[model samples]
Target: MPAPASAPAPAPPSPHPLRTRPFRLLFAGRTLSLLGDAAIPAALALAVQEATGSTAALALVLACSMVPKLLLLPLGGVMGDRFDARTIALAMDLVRCVTQLVVGVQLLGGTPSLAVIASVEVIGGAAGAFATPTAAPLVRGTVPEAGLQRANAAMAVAHSASRVGGPALAGALIFTVGPGWAFVLDAASFAVSAALLCAVRIARVERPAPGARPSVLTDLREGWREVRTRDWYWSSLIGHSAWNGAAAVLMTLGPGIAVHRLGGGAAWVALLQTGAIGLLLGSLVADRVSPRRPVLTANIGLATYALPLLLLAAGAPAVVVIGAYGLAQAGLGFLTPVWETAVQRAVPEHALARVTSYDWLLSFAAMPLGYALAPLAASTWGPGVPLTVAALVVAACCLGSALLPGVRRFTGGPDPVAPAGAEAVSLPGTR
Candidate 1:
């Protein structure tokens, strides 16, 4: 018999996700989008305060952005799974671009009523909700499994850079050209991001024929089932949700404290922003370091985020507060890439977006309450009281989350086992 031809050897593995054209474009898109995201908070806060002179109005405007995002996050996940993530992302960015452009025009023309600004934010936030659930799915699909850590690190690096630069730019523009130009620039950024996203491609699991496609309820339930089966996942969500509730105090009151108490203006924005330098430092570390128990490592490290609130509540100087924020955010930065890679590795690819939506929902659900309550609490007991409470909440959640049985041994990959030659790390229920 004629010799059977050998199967061609598998193509050599890619060294990194950055080497791939699609991932590179996606990276660019994300970098641009985050810049706009980072800038929006400062701009909106300033504009609302300037127009209404009412702190309640500012909170309502912020709430408008957040509430819709929380409400629509789940449906966004469904869309991510059922359709093209790239297309969903691109369409949402287009809508956001237009919304911001119109708002920018209005802000430039005159100080609109609180109602008008809040209404504009409502539309913008809704678009954000739909857009967010697609992000993890796209990232999960972008690179080979082995490259996930590096891919996430790269994205984090970009995000960190944006955080540092975005706020600086926002403060400058807001201080000089006025808040109006900041909105215009943010709108332009979304357009650029959408264009970049449109160029990047991601592979998707094709749905059944139109007549045979699963109902939305069925899809949601399947996603819910997946969440239920994983104790580590659900527990982590609970921990994150608690932490988010506390974290919101920073957004709700941090800037005001910096301005009113700490002798801050635009410098407040820059100081807060400089915290992302720690994130960049953490990403640099992640690129070189591999964790045997990624979730455990993340848990142990993230407990330090309580420091900034503690220091700020104690009335630390701007430089000191900035240092604490840097330290805290570094822990978060280190957790970001590892946690993401771990989850992507653990979940079946097709259902990741839906599960991610659940993650987003649980994590963010309490933030609006935090925003609503923090200012009121501050008003009653002084701003320091809320900051103190936030510090305590963050410390409790981080330490408690680290103690969960499933979290300690979560190594993150197909087998979910300790790395070769490493013994299993002890947990409450370990053998």
Candidate 2:
């Protein structure tokens, strides 16, 4: 028989970032951070609702937290780029730890004034503004470029796992003891996170040349330019903004729904738990599938972001609502890694934080508005009607983006290569 053609050499295995010490430390710290974060909202919501019997008051408290973060996010991004991101993250956590500890102590004494709680939330929100922007840049710093998708997926797993435990545990604590203990737990979690980060260090970032340094205004201007000039990027932001707004409404109204409409805290926790499980599964899918056309896959999946809201609007049974929310979260999970990988790869490393800040600022722009509107609408039309409206809004924005010029065409990050005649893929990690 004729000599068989030599088999093609096997492709080299890609780097696994979690194996590296720095990345492991970063991951552990961030995992702890997310646990605290996930606990805060549910605990805060219950505490505020109990202290003040009005949904509007609850909305105001949450809005106070969100508005500052929204306004300060761009500045936070600038800080992330200019300073040591790790240092900034650590400092922010310490600030959050102290503030939360104080708030929890007060709550332990008695139901504090609504004003006092809101003020504390404001401080926590400010710290969050700086902390949130640092996360992406910090991840980029710790993990290898080739393993960005895996790192992100791993963090998503951490996030989902934390959410699964945090909210339910917080709810149970609120039921048994009080919201105070939940807050204390979160404070402890932040302190732990800070300790982990302090021990793990990275090389100092080089300073920009004196001539090359841009004013904050110039950095903001440049970041905006990058976003607005890109059809896909801007459209994606707009789409996500709508979904965010819808989610804001849910955050404002969901607790009330669980407490009064559905059953109580346990039901709320179940809803969150189901969604968390779906998010976990979907993130695993992202790590495995790295969809061939990431933009297309992400945007297409995003249209489902509002499905749970729609189900809730219909006054579905608890199981039905939870199931829909889980499905929606999974769809959202599919988009998260792809979009993040795209941004990390496409944006210049030097400007990544600023660009990320702009993205966050824009994404959060509509949230406060939705939050402000939710209570008012709930008072007038009830939560279901407004939730239904929010769902439609999400659909309009996301589906509309998919129809945009470049929303489905622009796929960034590590582009995947395929054999001749095979369709293009997003990355090699994807199946």
Candidate 3:
């Protein structure tokens, strides 16, 4: 009797994602873009005030920027899947660069007209709608599967740091050189980001068989089908949307509570600063752990957010509220990178952007609605009522999602029953 052949050895782990050239380029480009993104809110607000000086005008400009992104995200997702994600992202960077340049030059010349500001914002918003969905695919193309979580954690750290520093940078520029200069610097960041992206080399994805592609509507349907069939993914989206809505409620009410019940604006500022620190630390920690059930773990982590809301509803001391808020933000920080890594690992590469766009759309859709309704609810029933309700909704949705079989069984490897027609692209230097 012949001995059975020994099983083949497993492949050795790849080097850290940051050590790879492609990932480095992608990371640099994305970090620059994120910093610019962080600066935009403050710069835009100042520009609107200096030019139009109306709160309504400010709101309108923000709406102009936001609504288009929400409406066009699905379209962007399709484009990302159909075309080269790197190219699409690079093009959008250039488009946004030009838009910011236009705004900067106008502000430099003196008060630009409201029409000019609004129009540029519209263009930027539309471009962002298309660009946002490409990110997951880009990361998938750059980093190997083994290092995905680390890559995401590094990106989250950049985001956390930017949240702390970007606004301060904007304020410094705005006060010393003027808001025009801030916009110009932001434009320059985009230009630099575009250059970095241009240097990034990704493997060429094979196009689908000729006429294998379907109409735009059909593509949309396919993306929807992909999302609907995944029980874990859709359930997580529900929990995430509830989390966003509840956070909005907190934001709307927290300020008033801090002012009237706590000390004042300083207390709110302390809370924000503490939360930012917690997020930074959480990002650091997320890189260290490997959860067996990624979706369930992330959702349970997200449930920590309910603690702060409950504390606020109970009229806890300012120190207590602030500590809970920081802990909550830390939970979010841990959840985000893990969730993103899980999605990247499990979802098919071909439809990644399209599926993620649905994730983005639904996760964000509730925020504005929450912002609008929270105040109304509070006015009618008092702040405590809405706060308490928001807390319960967040806790319920997160914990309930965790209990689902699909979510529990998800180990953040490839999907066991991935749909037909899913394609995996080959990349160099990692896998």
Candidate 4:
């Protein structure tokens, strides 16, 4: 008998994802783009206050930017699914570049009216709706399955760093030059991002031939089907929305508690900075963490948010609140990359963007509601009551989601069972 064949040599370990030129371009472009995007809140708030002065006017301008983005997200999902996602993303970058450039030039020339500012912001925000959902597909297209977690974690780190750096950058520019220059820099950032995108070569996802293409309504139906069919997906989304709503309450109340009970503005600033740092650390660690049930583990991590809320409700010392808040933010940071990678792996490439849009829409819609309701709840029952309630809600929702049958066992691939005759959708090696 022939000697038993020796086991084949193991395949060489894949190179670090960043070592790949395409992912490197993608990583750099998104980081720079997010840095610019992060600068917006601070710079825009100041610019609006100077231009309009009234808090109500400022709120209206901000709402104008947000509401359209939310309203058009479904359509954005369809566009991402229907077209070449990279091209759509690139075009949106150009559109935003033009819009931001126009806004910046106008601001520099003189204070544009609230109407003018709001109008331009609507255009920019609408572009963002289309742009946002394309991200997962782009990552999946550009990186190997083995690298997905690392790629996402790397991006998450960039995001957390940008959240810190962007505000500081904006503040410096606003003080030295003007807020107008910040927007100009943002526009320049988008232009650079677009150029980088022009160089990226994403794997083509096969689309239906033109003659057989589905209608937008059909696409929407299919996307919904994809979501509703996955008990894990829809259930997790509901839990995530609850988490968002509860977090909003904490955000709405934390500053006041910090300033009045803990210390002063410095206390709140320190807490924010600590949270940002925790986010950076958590993102760094996410790539190394592999759990048997990733979705369940991530939700368990998310439930930690309750600790900070409970601390705040008790009027804990600044140091205590700072520690709790940092821990909670770290949980959030870990959840971000792990959750993104899980969804990318589980969902079919054809409908990934659409599914993600639903993820964005529901989770985001809850936030404004939470913000609006938190004050009312506090006014009626006191801040402690709301904060305590938020803590319970967050913990319950996240833990409940984690316990859901589908999520508890999910291993980042298609459901093992499929409808009769339909092929199960899955990424190789994911299961």
Say which candidate scores most in lDDT.
Answer: 3
As a whole number from 0 to 100, the lDDT of residue 37 in candidate 2 is: 73
Clash tally for model 4: 0
Query: Which 10 residues in a row give candidate 1 its minimum summed lDDT?
Result: 422-431
Q: Give candidate 1's whole-model lDDT.
A: 0.79
Model 2 compared with the native: what TM-score? Answer: 0.83
Clashes of each: 0, 0, 0, 0
Candidate 1 lDDT, tens digit per residue, 1-431?
99999999998865888998888988888888788778888888888888888888987887798889988888888778788788989999899898888878888988566777788899998998888888877786667677889999998888888878887888899999888888898888889989998787676554657788788988888778777766677777766776677778887788888888778776476666667788888887887788998887876667676788888899888888888788777887888888888887787666778889998898889787787899999999998898888878777766776677777767786535422322221112211
In angstroms, give how far residue 122 of model 1 lies from its true place: 1.3
Looking at model 1, residue 232 earns an lDDT score of: 71
Per-residue lDDT tens digits for candidate 3, residues 1-431, read 99999999998877888998898999998898788778878888989998888989998998888889999999999999899999999999999999999999998999687898898889998999899998888888888778899999998999999888888888888889888887788788889989999988775556576579888898888888888888899998998999999988999999999999879999998998889888888888898887899899889988988998888888999999999999989988898889999988887777888999999898778888789989999999989888999999999999999677899899998888876555555454545
Q: How many clashes would you count in candidate 2?
A: 0
Query: Model 3: residues >4 Å from true position, as ranges?
Result: 1-13, 420-431
List, residue by residue over 1-431, the lDDT tens digit for candidate 2. Answer: 99999999998977776887887898888887788777777778777777887888987887788888988998888888777788999999899998889879878988567988889889988998999888777777776567888888888778878867877787788889988988898888889889888876554445477688879887777667766766777888888888888988987898888888778888888887788889888888888777756776787788786888887777778888888888888887878877887777666555567778877887788877887899999899888888989989889888888787566666565323321222221222221
Report how far off residue 103 is in candidate 1 (Å).
Answer: 1.0
Any runs in candidate 2 off by more than 4 Å, and if so which?
1-8, 45-57, 109-116, 175-178, 201-207, 210-212, 250-270, 312-320, 374-385, 414-431
- Expressed as tens digits, the lDDT of each residue in 1-431 for candidate 4 is 99999999999987778998888998988998899888888878887888888888878888888899999898899899888888998999999998888878877988666777899899998998999999998898889988889999999999999988988998898899888888898899899999999999887776778899879998888888888887788887877898899888988888888788987989989998999999988898897886778788888888888998898898778899899989988988998999899888777787888989999999889989989999999999889998998889888888888666898889876567642322434434322
Per-model TM values vs. the true structure: 0.84, 0.83, 0.95, 0.95
Between candidates 1 and 4, the one scoring higher on lDDT is 4
